[model samples]
Target: MQTESNGKRKRPKKKGSRFMRNAKGFAKQGIFGRGTHIDDDQFSYFINILDAMKAGFEDVEDRVNMANNVFEQTVDKEIHLSSNQIVSKAIESLIGFVDDAQLERFFGKFGDNLRPMCSDRFASHVLQKMLEIAFLRGLGQAAAQEQSEADAPGPAKRAKPDAAQVEEQYNLETDFSDKHREQCRNFVLRISKFMLNNLEDFVWDSCATHIMRSAILCLVGIHVPKIAFEKGGAELAKHRKLYTVPEEWHEVMKEFPQRLELWPQFVDFPYQEHSSALLGVICLSLSVVDKSMLKHFGKKILTQSLLKPNEDNGDDDDEKKESKIEIDDDNDDQGNNEKQDDNEKTEKPNSEPAVLLPKVFHYQCAVILLETLLSVAGAKLLTQLYAMLFSGRVAHLSQQQQTNFAVQRLLQHIKEVSDFESVFTELQPQTEQLLKMGYTGVVSALSGACLRLGAKQAQMIAALQSALHVTGDKEKSKLFFNCLVKLKPHELLAGDQSGFVHLHGSLIAQHILQFNKPIFLVNCILELPAEQLSQIFNTPNGSHIVDAFLQSKYIGEKSRERLIRQLDGFYVDLAITRHGSRVLDQCFKAAQEAQKLHIAKELSNKANMLKGSPFGRLIYTKYRLDTYKLSASQWQASLGQQQQKEESVGQTNKRPAKTATELFKDILTQ
Candidate 1:
């Protein structure tokens, strides 16, 4: 009986043991494995099983059950399994096996698995494959049905389904499709919805947000042209379409617009935590949606927020109330009581302000919205927006810095997309207000913006000159000089006939000395006509410029030679004054060998005169130390040694000398 029972058990276990063991091993080692590096043998084994199932093998049900188990296990894990390629291959093969009757069920399961895996890089690849396959299958089926209807006899035509029934059927197989392009639309919309719903999750979660954002961008990239087409029609499709979308489909277009309406919310999300990623989504959406729609919405919101009164306005009201209280105090007998009431009215509670949004954020939103408008609504809307920004309607709402930032961003867009000359010309009138506010930053930004606008060099120089003429503040003067130097307005400052010397010559000279490219300015000075160069060197501030140029490492041999020649006759006179002495000393160091010899000869002749003057003595001593390459102590030591040697020689030759005075006195006394 024991042998009989053993034989029976062995036969039962051996019946389907080979297939079952292979399936189990694939599910464990290949499908739910830890690493992504799958060997070819394991991958082939899984593909072969899928192919067998498609070929209607007897154990098809068993393989299907195993696939379901594999998908479930993969989805339950928070992190991705190494089975993306293996699972994608399995699904690709399985898609061929699925018929119309089971299409919806298959896709329902597929989408469920895809939702959790969208954030995974490799898993997202599998999801993309699912979408492409579904699209192709739907297209093939639609073509077949159309051909069948065309070939069928017309005598006994079947009644067409009503719109309600058609809608129901669409809903039933929404995950899959019978219409070619509608199916593609459904696939993209499904993924978009999934991405939108989980957008906050992906943004906040550090684990997989990068892959999620990439996937979102990819999905939007594929579907944007379709959305653009639905709104823009066929004419809009011909111009630089990034994606290929079908022109025939109108049914999916009906639902797609409503689905994408959530885009503006993402665009206007107040949190700046993941702003760059969010801006990408906004830009992508704007590519498809009608720019007029976003513009209309943006203008309304921007007007409300940007034109809203700020705390400064509230301060004005408080001041009015305080003045009224002072009048009451003067008229009433209860002065102390009235004062207490006034104090209570003026002192606000320590509660936090209701609105905490940063002014910069509001400005950034305005800029991004304006850019979106420009890209979508054309240049007309951009002009209107620009006018609004500078029209003084919302000007008080923005801080100076905020206004500067907004202007920079707006100008950047204009420079890229439109004729910047018109925009810059419009902004020219505001230069006075920008300067009056001491907003040198805005001035610099404007200068930079004008440069980018490809404005004429003369126009840019004129703008900078206007900015300089209005500001007497030392700090603003420095800022304007920096702007001029950066713009390299050499034509405006150089040449013998240039009015810079007559207008702001000392200021220009001082700035040129402090300029980053002192060599460029020095060369400009060297090329100046003899009269202008003389005038520059003669002024106190201009002498400083010459001093700075002579001391600069950037000064070349030719420039030094020219400068030394210019200073030939002025050296003695310059060395006698305080500021000029500094210039003369620097020139002494910078002068060439021939020039140095000339200067040294001149100074030696006037050594006694130089020693008597304070500023002259500084030039003489510096020349001696630098030209002779001797320190003061070394020269003094040498003098002492010479004196000692002379004394020794005198003593060696010494003899007892008779005093003539003593002999004369002795004669007088006798």
Candidate 2:
């Protein structure tokens, strides 16, 4: 030192250092260094410090190799462990890391120091694993901590809390069990969080049975408190899973009425407001599924909870009341005087349990649950539930809303899911239930749904044909016919020519004629009267009701004879329009012309007798004798004068001559 250190200071390479000059040489030679260090302390110190600092260096060849190895391993493991079993195992291990206190500490403490002690690449791989373990453990710890804090006693708290505090406590215990239960007492909020934070990863990630059960338990556990199980029920449920039906479910299965009574207090717990409310509806709907589930308690509980008085700030009771009133008032006054109006309006009693739900959402949920019950539940139960739901007797929603909802649901089921095909079948439970609902425009709903779902023309026509054959209700049949008229080749009926509506209309028109329902037939004529029918015929390949009738296999000889007899009543109205007038004139002229031709020869013998009756008889005898001698020009002139006289009288009477062929057609239709 005193001689000014003439030689340069040689920096020693750090142990496990990748930046050492020999590192490139070692890597190039494929020589692995395990727990080895260069003899140069200064160089080793610099490399170790760089690694510890987590800073990248361009000149560090060993560090680069380490990074490359880490990237490769991550890609490889990710591909290799992609199965559900692997994901499940990994999730279990991750959960174990969080749940185990000792492992958490071990990973936390050793994670930093171990990094620089090994090769940079190997160190990084270990570090990533350690971090995942830490995070998993931390999440469990946080959940546990929150649970404990919730159970903790307050300092010098009042012996009896205020109503607000009491309510809060009840809410905390029952509904607010989600991770953020304290922050927001909303089930949707919690579900949204869970879905956003966990669902996507868990969907694809490997998870163990316990881990998956734990996740599902977390969701189910949120509902148990409101369900009024033991104090530790949520915790117990966390361990328990829905691998099979609960023993309690079976025990209370026979005592559904009793369960129904207590179920409400638990149903709308503060934590699971909307979902529990939905589940409660589903629970009540079980009665619809299995009538045996309809315990007195269950019915009472449903009545109480669903019909509860709303005192909350955001309650929609008043608006619903107003809307109901408005609908009722409108219904009472309309001139249409629909069949539905005569039904009694059933009001939910004020003593009934508070619905605590938003009405629109409630309506939507009720509709869905009702439809589901119809599909899966027993007939007796369906009858009861349908009676109960519609018993409120207030069809509070607008006609358009109801129709739109039905069509939308039907379309969604048909077009979006294959499982929903059951609804379209006659054998399906929903088909019978749909008939029982007795919706005024139910046929319209079906037709609209079929149109939107892209149902084939033949299939749709067959469905209608079947419905018509089995149906006993005339109004329903009429509604079906009317719907066909409204939507033909518009809104839903697409294609250049081949659609169900075209065929359906023809079939229905033929049915009306065959059935001899003159009013309906007349109504059809009036709506798309004879004039319109002819116009339709004029369109290329557009066969009117007449053509359909002529071609119909359904109409028998007897029915056709009856229809032809009835045509006389329609002739007067038909004559007003151009097509009707033309058809009538042609028919009359043809009949008269044939009659005149047949009778012309017979009239000569009768005319010869007219001259012999009196003194003129002798002169007539001469005229009759002279007629054979009369000139061709004179006979022709006499015939022309007689025809002119007959034509003028026919015009004065405003009647057209009838044709024999036209008369025959009329007879055939009758």
Candidate 3:
């Protein structure tokens, strides 16, 4: 489902700029924006911005001079430079990537330049980028670096600096801190004034609306990474840069001039009917990802890695590279052909016919933007989002091109039974159709949401079973499990045919295993012959299914023991590999006393192989195979105390906290 698509699925294409004939226009050429009497200095800023984004301040001086000089030639006296050209140039260069020196200059010029650009269609984008870059650079210059420096220990004061004495020390302070920071603050204040000054112009004017949203991001220091919508789903969605700014920046926005505050503008935006799409995306982004997590993880990782750019379920390989988007038209056409061929071969005669999705111009930006929002959304914020978006439209949205992605992401965040049912009710009937129609990502995300919320496990399985054409218990064959595991269909079971770990399908398997009543799936999985299981045990993600089984509270201890018993003969083989060794280690930890002995005895005989592997040696030492070799009885006895301690610790964690009154009464009695 994630790796292949069968439906006539439509993906948003990058809208190319209007191409001009080479011989027709007798003028110097540039990327994106073009105009009469072009100002080389202004346009070169974009070239500089592009360099900053790609290479990050490398050869800054050379870029600055070269960029400043690019459009320097004098133009016709009567003609004026088009501001739209400026926007075309600016939008191509992401605002988040600009250098600080360039930022200081932009902030200084923004207020004077913003007025003309704010209302113009192409120019508004430039306005938004300037606001983002100025605040981003400003926050880094002041809040992140300066604050760290302020409290940092001096050479002499490192040993001692009492609070009272340090406060008493002479300190003369100029308002704010550095010139760069002042420019940032002024830029924010001026923008605030501009917005407050032109309330109706901003509210009614379509182009100016997003600038308000950008300012809100600046005020809050929330950067939703630029949403690049292309071909493919989460499997191909690689690590995208996540939004980050200093925590101290929030305080700075708070102290802005009261008359120029953005609150009124924010409050007024939602009343406009059209604001729903834009406002919904931005608001959810802020609400879903908590302020605290952004502060903690935001600094350490890129937003995509932080929010997780892939699927919402946090598949094992969350840190992997960009999803391979089918960019070339010919290559994309070829890929579609292959997927269709695969789908046709796999389609079951009894399987419900999938509804064909109409190919349409995808609202690619909106989809990407919403997906980005869902990525950052925190667990605590799920309740709010569930109430806001999921209201009897889950299926309707899933059927459409743009909203399907939003639904896919939203489903991943579902936490309550009510929320799941609300979504499941609308989506249940079409679940099979959606799966057949190449929307397996939607199904995979739904499974993940089910597992996360602990809702509708039986119903979810039923929907999938029917979809997989294994509605009857007897019909559930290795092929059914295989189809579900690969998220692709097969006319017959062929060993090792499933390629590159069908990511979405594997996610479905992992999610199903974690469910409270995952016996059916577990049984189906256990049937995957030892050879197949061996392959699964060693895979980067497939092994996660094993982890899900071992780690799930719902899966019975007996089922876990059965798994260990099943792996009995292969214990040594498993212990000598990376992922397999981890699985073995987990199995031993979760294993019953006898099961542990079984694993240890097997590993004890293969000491040479175990010691040879880096992972294997750790397993050998951790399991105390040498002690087992000395005496099985002694090894078994040595583990008794450890097992007892582990059980006690587990019980302690599971135990409820004492009430204050009860604790007080117990203390008095003692």
- Between prediction 1 and prediction 3, the one with superior lDDT is 3
lDDT by residue for model 2 (515-575), tens: 3222444343434433434443333223344544443454454543333333443433333
Model 3, span 1-670: residue lDDT tens: 3344542245555332222222113225544354423455555554454434335333334533443333232122101332535424434243333334544544544455676667776556656656654554454422321212223456533555432122112111112246765576567656755764675567567767667655655565444322211222332222111234544544433332222223544332222433433444344333323445332322222222222222332333322211211221257677687557447745764532222111110334434544544555455445444554445446756765556777787786555577678888878888877866677778888888788777877888888877767654575554566777666544433444643456677888888887888888888877767766776677666767787888888888788888888888787888888778878878888888778888888898889988999878988887788989999999898888778988898777552555333332222111
Question: Could you arrange the candidates by lDDT from highest to lowest?
Answer: 3, 1, 2
lDDT of candidate 1 over 320-426, digit per residue (tens): 54565455537566666665654675486552222223222354444444434444333454566555554332222223443454555455445332445655565
Regions of candidate 2 where Cα sits further than 4 Å from its true position:
1-265, 269-290, 294-301, 309-363, 373-395, 398-670
How good is model 2 by TM-score?
A: 0.26
Specify the highest-TM-score model's number.
Answer: 3
TM-score for each prediction?
Answer: 0.33, 0.26, 0.54
Q: Per-residue lDDT for 599 in model 1?
A: 71
In model 1, how large is the Cα lDDT of residue 213?
39
RMSD (Å) per prediction: 32.4, 33.7, 15.7
